[model samples]
Structure formats: C-alpha cells, structure tokens
Target: MAKTIAVEYRVHDGPDALAHAAAEHFLEQAQKSVAAKGKARIAVSGGSTPKRTFELLANPKEKFLQAMPWEKLELYFVDERTVPPTDKDSNYRMTREAMLDKVPLKPEQVFRIKGELPPEEAAARYESTLRNQFKLEGAEVPRFDVLALGMGDDGHTASIFPHTAGIHELARLVYANQVPQKDTWRVTLTWPVIIQAGEVFFLIGGKDKADPLHRVLQGQYDPETLPSQLIQPKNGKLLFLLDKDAAALLPAPDASGKGKLEIQR
Candidate 1:
C-alpha cells in the first residue's frame, strides 16, 4: 500500500472564524517558540489568506499583541510579486499595512523582498541579504521557525505556479521566473528554503481551491499540474488550516487506521 499523507487539519465554517483561530494559534506557537529559542523566525505568505490573518492580529482591540514580544519575531516573505513596495501587487506592502504597522515589531526585524528592482537583481540582492542576515555560512538553507503559506485555485503556492519550470528548482533560496498563463513574473522562496521550516502551515481558502486541495493532499496529482503538490516538506511538519467549502473533495477518515484529521471551532 502507498504510504498515507500525515496532515492535521482545523476546519472553520467561514474565513473569519478560521482567520481568528489561525491568528490565535499562530501567536501561541510563535510565542512558545520564542520563549524557548529567544526568537521566532517566520517566512510569511502572500494573498488574501495572510491578509486576513494579519488584519486579525492587527486588531487594536487585541491586548494579546501588547503582551507578546513582537521584537523577537523576525518576519520574512515567502514570495513577492514583482512590484514596488507601495504597489497593489506587492505582498511586502500588504503585510506591513496589515500587521507590522499596528504591532511594535521593530523595523529591522522586517525583511522585505525588494521587488522594485529588476527581477534578477532583486533575487540576487534578496538572496545575499538572506544569507548574511541568517549568517548561513555552511547551511544549504536557513531554518525558519515557521512558514505560513496560501494556495491558489490552481494549487499554486507562493509564486510557484503549475507547469512552470520554476517548480524544478530545488536548489535556490529564491527564483525570478515567469508564469505563462498569467503572463506575470515573481520572486519566490524555493522548496530548498521552505522545507527547512520547523513548522509549515497551508492557509488555503475559498470554494475554488477545493478540487486542487484534494489532488494535493492525496498525492495523485502531477507536480507540473499542481504546484502545491510539490510542497511536501521533507523534514518539517505540515498543517492545513481550511474553511468548510474547501474540504468538499476530501474523504472522511477511514476505519483502517488512517490518521485522524483534527478540527475545532
């Protein structure tokens, strides 16, 4: 028999519920990790899912933000659409406006992708900056405390779109490439870097993503057909934080000793 995928899940009836739970869960994990390690290094995702999570965290009413150690959290991007920081397409800007502005996270702790520069230059500079900041002399990739990700209907994670040659790049920390269908380019953290995460969360949402999510979770999909399928972490743990609609294609846990899919309100 084929080895089964090990995935823990938390399904919410809607996005707001999921976002609140996810934000709280993320802070708890980040806090605990920081408490033990003295710092939390996280590579965050782009798209509406992260925007919702950040907005939830940025809620001025949340006293928890004041108590947590924001200074100890080093924030990095999982990917950047090629645009200026102020551009609507820029993930760097979205994260800053959503979370960094309200929190007292120090400016130095926010490492942004310089998408304003020429694509090649941006990738090179960002790569060099990552190496220096992490002080990674002998390591293939910097180990991050957490990696938060979002998925598209096409099963693309970050900017790694389906059928793109970038999917085969298992060696670079970041890559500058084109997604032909969309006729756009992006700079993304490759699997080499993402797999080094101590914890990786797939923040998938929307009704459109249901089909591909099933394909990915089952491992029957081709990597070239669904980019997110290639995201099976070699060492890190994976979690799928989903909304109810996105779970439509998934089967129920079987009686044959399949692992339980954990869920909560």
Candidate 2:
C-alpha cells in the first residue's frame, strides 16, 4: 500500500527569487544538520535553477556565501552525464564553474561521479564510494542530511527517465541508466537512495515545466510514466521550490507564496 505524503511548496516571483529561496533552504538544511550531527552531507542535482542557487551560495554579496559552513559540509552529486568532468555537458563542470571553484570547500569534500568512466563502472565506483563513506554494514543506505533534486519537462528526476530501467532499481544505491530517448547514458543515484535522505526537495522553474510539475504533484501515481513520483522520501515529507511559471498549473499559493498538498506515494 502506498503511504500518504504531505508536500510543501513555495512559489517565487521569478527565477532570481527562486534561486534565493533554494540557496536559503540549502544553508538552513546544512546548519540544521551540522547542529544535529557534527557535519552535513548533501547531494545536489544539476540544472539551471540549481546552478543559480550555487552561484548565489558562492557570491560574496550574498549572505549564504559567508553563512555556509564549507568546512563541515560534504557535497555529492545526484547524477552525472556520461562525459568527462571537464566537458561542457558535465554536471561537475557546471558546479565547479558556478560554486565549487569559488567556495572554500576542500577537494576531498566534493565527491563527484566519474562520468568519464564506462557507465556501469562509474555507477559501481559511486556505489562503492557511498558504502565506504557511510560505512554501511549490510543493506544500510546513506541518509544524506539533504538531497536536492530537479524535475525534467517529462516528469523525470535524477536521470531516471520515464519507462527506463532506473525506475525499477530498488536495491542499488546508484544505477547506470541507458536513456534511449536521449541516446545517452547516465549515472544516477537510485530512487531508493534518494528516498532515504533526511531532507528531500526539488528546485524547479521555467514555463516548460508547468504541465509536468502539475502532473507530478496533482496527477495519478504512475511512476513508470512519471519517474518523479517515485521520490517519496522515507521521512514522509517533500519540498518544492518553484518559480511562478512552473507553479502556474498547481494550486494557487497564498499571499505568502506557500502551498501544501497531500498525495499518496
């Protein structure tokens, strides 16, 4: 039986506001995690919205740059394209250009998926890294302090394309997904791993995402067709930060730009 999940979302006026909200959320989660534990482990997905958020976090003018506890944070990627880290399409490259290079975080603190390697090998290596880092004994999964995600126009998230093999992955922490529609391969953290995170949120924007966002949150629960629906965190809550365009099809937000819904997983 599917469980009910209470999803909370905030809609911003525009892209800049959305980015600011995401950056603030990131900092808040990191601080909360650091206060609870000694350090914060967060996994982030790559996209235009996330890139903007990263830049905001790294910008000297922004409070997030100074407020972020870089030394006590361990950053990870939610997925990576099958390209070299230096490639233009690489998520690692985007993050480095946007935030990593400017941040005070050490190299060892960023655990990037080796997208240059063969798809299966890269997934295996990432899984091994997680196991070693989290010190998993049996079937234990790493409970990241925060997991940031992005939704595709097709209702996909974390490289788990609709009707892809990645959607069925339950035991693996990571997966090598072959996306026929894109004619490319990707290494992604599996849904199981994503759902195990302590905090899970999706940062989405753009008018192109309006329909998909509506379907993902308000439509039927068909994960095979809408992979984003598979992301039902074990903690029973999900968060969404959206720009006005993307939130257009969803229920109208209050004057405070906040909205809440209860959906079945």
Candidate 3:
C-alpha cells in the first residue's frame, strides 16, 4: 500500500454535514472498540472541521451523536494552541465547549494541554501524561485506537508547520514551535508518536482545503513539505475522510484494493 486512503463522500454540499458524519463515524468506531476491550483511546485534531465535528458530537441526544459509550472512552488533543485553556484561542476550550464537558468520561481520562505553563514545561508535562497512559518512554509512540487530524491550507497538520525544528523533535511527547507571524508557539505530538497510532483519520473538507488535500494524497509523503504525509499506522490503518472538493484532484484506485478506498476524482 502507498500508505493513505479515503472514506465515503456523504456529500452535504457543506462542511457541517461532512463534519457531523465524520464525528459520528469516530464515535461509532470507538464504541465498538471500547465495548470489546473495556476502554477506548483517541487523539483528536485541532481545526475548523473537527471543531464543528466536536460540536455535533457534544449533543449525544442527536441522531448520529446518540448512544455513545462515553464512560468507556478517553480523549486526547492532537495539538494545543499554546495559550491558557480559557483564552479564546485555546484548543482545550473549543473541545470543552464542544464535547468534553458533555461526556461522562471521568476527569482523569480527559487530558487537557497545560498551555498556561512555559512551552517546554507544558510539553514535558504532556509527555509525562502520555507516558503514564501509553506505558511508553518519551521516545516511543503511543498506539491509540483512533487519531483524528485536520489539514491546513499551508499543508500542515497538528502544530507541525512547514520547515521547523518541531518536525525534527525526537523526544518530549510534546514540543514548542516558534514559528513567526502566527502564535509564537504550539504543543504537538511528534510524527514518530502520531504515526504509531493504530488508526489515523484526517477530517478534510471545504473548497479552500482542496489544494493541500491533493498534495497530501497525490504528492510526496514528505514531512518537510506536508507534515500530514508522515502520519501512517505502523501496523494498523490510515483513513482520510474528505468531501468532494477535497477529493477532486486525487487519483482513484480499483475495486480490488480491499484495504483502501480510493475516491476517483
């Protein structure tokens, strides 16, 4: 396999519908995995698509959002915006308002980024948290059941922007990215850790995202160019759930590749 794949279109002609569907799919898979193993773990994305998906996921009473076994689930942020939780830009607040506060997942299972601390300290703190849960050393990756990702117009995923030291970080489960123009820093999982996840699903939608999505799917799987390209399951799978616009430029695969769902442009 070339190491990336896509899911059904379920086109709603809008971002909300695709986001809701993707969120529901995530919940469904987690429920089943947890039911069979008594626990489920997730690493989630930070962006508009997942933010919308989180809002829909928060309303468990709704159709697709309903019947989720939250008690058996654990949540993790894929990236943090390097601000305190209450700050308007914090990813934790967005997730809290969207899903965490509404779910019955115990407090300990809901890991939040300590952005209020110094970037290095916050990253170290997050590394300790992950080590305890994954039972892994700082240099090893965690095998989470599912990891949701989002794409940037700049072709970056998580806080891993273009050509930075953050991309080369080998330890400290989290790290500080000192990119200019944007926020001075962000906390994100290293590629080695993220790719080790059992299932890596990227939620890509919107017309603005089409170009980057094409680059990620059809272009080189080069981390220097697109950090997202490096996210691949060591022994599990990778799923790219995209809308029509995002899939427009990708080449299609045949019906025989059972493990991959290639969407014909």
Candidate 4:
C-alpha cells in the first residue's frame, strides 16, 4: 500500500521572508540529523529562490551559521543541467557561489553530478555514488535527511519536466531525461528516490507560479501535466513553503492567518 501523503503549507509575505523561514527550517533539520546520526545528507535543487536561502545559510555572521554542523553536512544536487560546473547555467556553480564556497564543508562532502558527461553516464555514475554512500540495495532508496526543491513556472521540479519520461520512472533511483523542447538533457534523481526522503520542501515564489501552485496544491493529482504534484513523500513530511505571490491563488486563509490546507492521498 502506498503511504499516505499529508501536505502542510506556510505562506510568507514575500520571497525574502520565505527564504528566512526556509533557512530556519533547514538549520533545524540539519542540527537534528547531526545530533541523532552524526551527519546530515541534503539534496538541493537549483533556482533563483533557493539562492536566497543558501546565502542566509552561508552568512558567517548569521546566528544560525554560528552553530551549524557544517562539517557533518553532506551536500548533493537533486538534478543538474548538462553543463560543466563552471558554466553559467550550472547548478553546482550556482550553489557553490551561493553557499558551499562560503561554508566549511569539505570538498569531498559536496557531491555534484558531472553534467559535462553524457547524460546516461552521469546518471548511472551518480546512482552508484548514492548507493555506495547510503549502502543501498537493489530495491532500497536512499533517504535524504533534507530534500530542498524549487518549482518552475511550468510546475516541474528537479528536472522532472511535464510529460517527460523521468516522471514515469518507477525503478531507477536516477534518470537521464531528454527535454527536446529546450534541446537539453538533464540528469535527475527520480521520484522513486525523492519520495522516500526524511523531509521534502518546495520553495515556490513569484506570481508566475500562482496558477500552477494552485492546481498542484488544490487541484487534481496529475503528475504528467504537473510534475510537481509527483512530490509525495512516503515516509516524511511534505511542506509547501510559498511566498505571498505564489500562494495568491490558493484558498484564502481562515481566522488564524495561515492558509493551512491538508491533502491526503
């Protein structure tokens, strides 16, 4: 039987506020993981909104950063574009400039997809790396301590585009997705792996995403047309951390000032 997907939401006044809340949650999860297991395994996605949160985490003078178990945190990418780490469009580059470079995480602690290689080869290699790191078996999934994701305007997340083959992968932990619309190939951790994480967060902002967020949160369960809808964490919490603009189309909040909505599947 499929585990129930219970979703909770928090709507912030704007992107900056949303970023702050996300950073706080991220640090709390990291500290809790490290205290319980001596390590925190995090898989982060690429996007402009995530950059703000990353910056907050990287700021040394910030109170949160002072006590962060930076060395005990292992960072990985949820997906990557088919580009070198130095490319302007590279996810690793964005993350490095935003947080990794500014933090004390060791070089080996940062696991990035070699997007410069063939998509298939990169995906296969990353799967092997993940399996070895987590000691995963044939049918086992590597449960990340925290999975930070961002939604695109089209409602896609982690390189899983709408109507794409990656969205339908049921066995593999990773996939090489061919997105012909943009003439680019993407290496991504498939939903099978993502849905088993310890915690999953969707950092959505801007007015452009309002309609899709509404449809994904308050509409039907259509993963093909709205890939973000596929993010149903089986054994962990699924949180939608949205800015006011992104949450604009969601059902109005009750007297408590939070647009709290629960969805079970």
Q: Sort all candidates by lDDT, best to worst.
A: 2, 4, 1, 3
- Per-candidate TM-scores read 0.91, 0.99, 0.87, 0.95
Task: List model 1 lDDT by residue over 32-140, tens digit each.
Answer: 8899999988889888877898988878787557756787898889899889999988998999888888888888999998999988788888888899988877555
What's the best-to-worst order under TM-score? 2, 4, 1, 3
Instruction: Give the better candidate number (1 or 2) by lDDT.
Output: 2
Name the lDDT value of residue 180 in candidate 3.
Answer: 66
lDDT of 3 by residue, 27-86 (tens): 788887887788889888776788788877777567644567777778898889778899
Candidate 3 stretches greater than 4 Å from native: 1-12, 64-66, 137-139, 181-183, 252-265
| Cα RMSD for candidates in order | 4.1, 0.7, 3.8, 1.6
Candidates 1 and 3 compared: the better one by TM-score is: 1
Model 4 pairs in collision:
none
Each candidate: how many clashes? 0, 0, 0, 0
Better of 1 and 2 by TM-score: 2
lDDT of 3 at 48: 71
lDDT for residue 129 in candidate 2, whole number 0-100: 96
Clashing pairs in 3: none
